[model samples]
Target chain A: MSPTTTEDSTSSNHGYAKTSLNTVNRYRGRGQYEYQHVYPIIDEAPILHVAFHGSPDQDDFAFPVILPMLGCTGNFEEDPNNDGRRSIYLHGYVSSRIMRLSRKNPASNNIAGAEGIPVCVSATLMDGIVLALTPNHHSCNYRSAVAFGYAQVVEDEPERLYAMELITNNLVPERWQHTRYPNKTELKSTGILRIDIHSASAKVRAGTTGEAREDLKDETMRTKVWAGVVPSRMVYGTPLPAPTNMFPGMPEYIEDWVEEWNEKAERYSAEAAGL
Target chain B: MSPTTTEDSTSSNHGYAKTSLNTVNRYRGRGQYEYQHVYPIIDEAPILHVAFHGSPDQDDFAFPVILPMLGCTGNFEEDPNNDGRRSIYLHGYVSSRIMRLSRKNPASNNIAGAEGIPVCVSATLMDGIVLALTPNHHSCNYRSAVAFGYAQVVEDEPERLYAMELITNNLVPERWQHTRYPNKTELKSTGILRIDIHSASAKVRAGTTGEAREDLKDETMRTKVWAGVVPSRMVYGTPLPAPTNMFPGMPEYIEDWVEEWNEKAERYSAEAAGL
Candidate 1:
């Protein structure tokens, strides 16, 4: 599958393979293990839910923490969507819990006899709510991806900068180039994590709702209940100028990006619902 | 906070209070601990990320799992938003790991009696991306809520039904009344977890983007960087009937609900960005 430069790039080629960690147990048919399919969903998502075991050595009580993080998947030299090999780059405060943990446990697989923090990152985009005649059949039309990887702190300055640039561009194309580059102080306070993905899977549920055959046969129930797909799309409204913005008006790039995303969101959502 | 019958009832009063578990450490000013403020965000969100610690007695590796679950906040008697006392009702498959774990460890406050399953439920609604002249100041205008609670399997039949009804209504108002009621078999296969919220807090960042004073003073940086809020909203598109739907077109309730939610999503998003 080729990646679509639009929102909800659900149609993409196989990139990751089925692994024990990334296998979709419940809805096997909807699962796509290829990197091409999984990376797009990861890239398109605005936030990634990072989950890790809290206090792994403690046997008294186990707590898992999941934090909403800003991240992107790509290498510095290649486009994330088109390239087969991609790593997730997550940004956090230098002294953050996740960052500190990652620093202590650096990636060692390549060097042998090394340990790294294990993390599971998940991203989801809801396309529509599938309303069925029966409540049992009600489902959501969504695109979701889960990735298992080892995360390590980025010690290299160039690699960290590259990751930061990728994350900024992920928010808005060419946003990094437009914004003031990070200074030494800013870079010192920020921490970057490079998650080397071991396995990943993408699950997509699209099209119309599915009703039970028995429910359809029941005329009373069929007439009384409405079964359909309520397509949900993320739209970008008109840009609002900042209080400190001394500029005359919103810039052309901001306007163009908003318009482009709005159109893509509507089109992709419609397509997902088979409109 | 009185719950609105209409879609996206963003207007509500304070409900929950500050506690040790639910306090916002990083940005204290943005934290809101009132039930009125927290419930609406939890209700408006499409999905809740449920995080819990994996095996407590194991000396081996610990794993934290985060699952996207369908849920709502309410009591049996009154509207959740209006009522000060509320519990989060989460719906899931009976055989799911979270459900099984929650059932094994019932919530108990007394010492040495029993260990309750501690869980953190979080919901986030992204309003817009706040582009700034400098990368350090860039942020997202969003409303997020985090609740710390002890989760236990809901065994009481009436409360279970009530929770089910609340969750169904959350999907679309009065949805439970229209769809065929669940049978004994259906109810048996499904499980509901009542998270008795001990503490909760909401963090909301709204209005336009904020640029650094230094960047604002720099004329060239100000002119080059486009700093503004690109409002993001989730919209509901035209409903599409299922192939098995023998009914004549979409129902009026479905049509009205879709239009109402679409408007609310747009309105709330714009308001969050101070557009």
Candidate 2:
């Protein structure tokens, strides 16, 4: 698993340089430029929001397209071209538009031979709903991260399999091994987009509601309103086996993982709310 | 609540025109263009992923910036210029970059009176984890929607209040009335961007795993692997009171809402898995 230490840093303040591109303008205290703070948000998020221009040509469409995609961050040990930083591996179909675009256009970044298309992948984790004295003061406690990079399809067989395993196991631990192995056609058809990061940032808003001084002073309003946070988390219910399944119910691996996930998610949400 | 009729339609086949801009080319069967199918996905998602170029000049950055924002869909009845279609109202701070951008730039759409900066708002609801026979076929059951629109700040006080109430209550039922009303200062400082949608579409993927025929034929592999969907949903836990809170326990309304939300969310997720 990717390291997720917020308070302790193994590396000494290593992060993206605060340029105009990666800086968080509003609520500056909540903004984090560190690798530990940002990468964890991307790895933990259930879904990633990816945005890219519809076509390789800039003039083709004025609006950028946003699609919900499944992906996770990983470092491929064998890839000599990899810059050592974790790259995002996105699970998609071979025929998807994003995959086709990435294959068509190589990135024209300052790097000597970067191969990819421009893209931004973002993820948000909602911890709790903050309710204050007034509607304006109400906010949701969240951890959000955005990474801008160049996305290219993984052509190497070993690298593609690595990404496939990384993504599958990321969703459910040991899921890659639990399932049947991919055949030749299946392996060929699966598309994995590896996003080489250029710059990124993470923003987090935690703790109880921050109310206005005027509202807090009003005794009547303070007493009348039910002010606090409602903790929220993604809960995994009982796994429903497919009709063709020979087994009667969820296997021990699946059930145990689901239980542990629900427990941790619940604990984190409540912890964020209290903070 | 916004209408959520998937199989039924209030109007006779009312939907956005099928344009190359909003088509789901990859999965044709899952694509939906109807108003009922699209708008609900935007409303139900916990947070919306909003994307727009960092600058109005466009050439400054090759990648579009993505931010997570809270919002809901509503139609303004009082506005004479209202096109009768639902518009997304985003809750943001007055000094936020998006709020400032919306105020500075007016949409250059064909409509003479249209005012706002161009934006794309997308939302995704993750229902379940679909575990297929092979890792290659592994997928998630999801409902996703994307809406392209022009977002302008709501200058009108009444319209602004409408949006505030809509957003507050959408996050929590009857939350607007329960809390202290927004004062003039609070109202003035708050930013609400109403997005007048131009084109939108929804895509949904549900049901049991659809595996390869070749994989299903292998009895040994089928029996060894456990394949199913792990249903998932956002669960609201008990109200976590802030240190400043006077109340000893959660109010009846908060308790009831949390209970109902958990039940509905759980039910829907499991149902989607079965479908």
Best by lDDT: 2
Model 1: per-residue Cα lDDT over B88-172, one tens digit each: 8899888776788787777533123324587778888888888877777778888888776668888889888888888988978
Off by over 4 Å in 2: A1-13, A56-60, A78-84, A108-114, B1-13, B56-60, B78-84, B108-114, B247-249
Ten-residue region with minimum lDDT total, candidate 1 chain B: B1-10
Docking class of 2: medium
Clashing pairs in 2: A207-A275, B207-B275
Model 2 per-residue lDDT at B44 = 85
**Native contacts, share recovered per candidate:** 0.60, 0.71
Q: A77, model 1: CA deviation in Å?
A: 7.6
TM-score of chain A of each: 0.88, 0.89
lDDT of 1 by residue, A1-275 (tens): 11233222222344665544455767679988777788889889998888765543433223455678899897654555554667799998888767877876664322222246777788889898888876767888899888766778888988888888888889888888877887788888888888766567888998887766667679877777778778887778888776666667766777788788878888888788873
How many clashes (backbone N, Cα, C below 3 Å) per candidate? 14, 2
Would you estimate the TM-scores of all the predictions? 0.86, 0.91
- Chain B TM-score of all predictions, in order? 0.87, 0.89
- Candidate 2 lDDT tens digits, A66-176: 989989989776454322357799989898888888888866531324468778899999999999888888889999999987789889888898998998888898888
